[model samples]
Target: MTPSVQSVETEDEYIHVRFRDPDEFDTIRTPDWAAHAAQDVSEGSEVRTGKQKDSDDWEVQSVLIKKQVGEDKARDEAKQIVEKIES
Candidate 1:
């Protein structure tokens, strides 16, 4: 099953992926995926399941980084909403 990554933690020699599924996780030694997951986790992004390498192995296919809106942009949006409501 493709599980959403709930958390990523660094260990002595591995990166642990805690899945949203209860008690489901994987210790990864693959450097590429590990690094990607680490960055995504730090950025509060979503890590998507790529493919299953085998019965016991899976790969990270993509990282979905959440875009942070600027404070000015948010304020502008709020102003627009207020104007719309007043109209």
Candidate 2:
């Protein structure tokens, strides 16, 4: 399934690319699509997936370290990571 990008924002020194996955429960048992994408990603990119303590939905976030590869590159790589999440 193709995940959708719910929003994008910058926090601290990282550009956060956020996506959502429906959770029937509070459990997040989906594949670590972000991690797998990170392996082939660049610019010190990283991803996190979890169900927030106060929310019943699961969120997938890809962060691009702005200090590492610059904002432009980081943004490109960040989106790429999200694209390659399951492709």
Candidate 3:
């Protein structure tokens, strides 16, 4: 099943991409791959996605972006990344 961004939140330099009832696409690999792909976005930016707690799911994740980037762009970028990865 395809996953959609359930919610998007922004912090100082981070964008959290939370999936809506994710299916098979939700795994350690999905977040790790996205994180790797996200880091290539810029020189200083970084991304992270993993289980904050062992009982939680990987669908809830976060990506760190450059401060100058807008939340809309960040979400769009994340959507592209997720689509590319899922395809």
Candidate 4:
């Protein structure tokens, strides 16, 4: 996992994760994951997931998180995204 850390935010069905590197930064989206998790989510809810810092790149981190969805469902979706990224 990367040492890089970021803040996460969700808007509608979209997720926005921001990583800070000063010179460079990255953001990841999981609309498909959100779609699946959305089924159990209300119109406005906060969903929190987990994030792992990269071992190699200190300025990089991999986060599998979702917001605006049910905890159980959002976790499931986050797991799916993690699996896909790992694959």
Candidate 5:
């Protein structure tokens, strides 16, 4: 699937890049939020999923992109996500 940007809601010092995943329900992989953010994503480029904490609960927190962001660029920002995770 070609990755595309989705709804974004920013507050104070945080910006969320919500990925559009339709079939995410069938596959659930809890990515390492901090590490993924640090190595792959850029600053202010926080990742968020629709997966919930529990069966009937909400997700814990949005994933983060640390140490890579430099002033927010669209193309560079897209490069900071793990496209595939081998389980």
Candidate 6:
């Protein structure tokens, strides 16, 4: 499952990201661009999926920003996309 971003805090040269669901956090040493981008992301706004590098450490592979939409609207859009793909 993808972990939802709960909060982000900067410390030294790393950014600490707290996550929901798994109830854990990871420290990321991101490039300057990514660090700046992280600051603008609101809590609960993005979902992160990654591979574990070691115990208590994760390497973020992708970050997905959540779009503002009603649940029903998102479901309808997903259905439409799936239908198009299947046709």
- Models 1 onward score TM values of 0.27, 0.51, 0.52, 0.30, 0.40, 0.25
lDDT of 6 by residue, 1-87 (tens): 333445544434323344432333344333444333433532222324333444654434333323444333333333332223223
Error of 6 at 64 (Å): 8.7
lDDT, each prediction: 0.38, 0.59, 0.54, 0.38, 0.42, 0.36
Model 4 CA deviation exceeding 4 Å by range: 1-66
Clashing residue pairs in candidate 2 are none
Tens-place lDDT per residue, model 5, 28-72, is 444456345534445445444445333543231333333333225
The prediction achieving the highest TM-score against the true structure is 3
Judge candidate 5 against the unseen true structure and give its global Cα lDDT, from 0 to 1. 0.42
lDDT of 2 at 59: 52
TM value for model 5: 0.40
User: Which residue runs does candidate 6 get wrong by more than 4 Å?
Assistant: 1-66
- Looking at candidate 4, the ten consecutive residues that score lowest on lDDT are 55-64
lDDT of 1 by residue, 52-83 (tens): 43456444433333335333332333233222
Model 6 clash pairs are none
Flag the better candidate by lDDT, 2 or 6: 2
State which candidate, 1 or 4, has the greater TM-score.
4
Taking the tens digit of each residue's C-alpha lDDT, what string does model 2 give over 6-78? Answer: 6566777777665653342354443555565675877455676566667765555435445546556666676
The runs of at least 3 residues in candidate 3 whose Cα sits more than 4 Å from the true structure, single-residue gaps closed, are 21-33, 40-62
Best by lDDT: 2
How many pairs collide in each candidate, listed in order?
0, 0, 0, 5, 5, 0
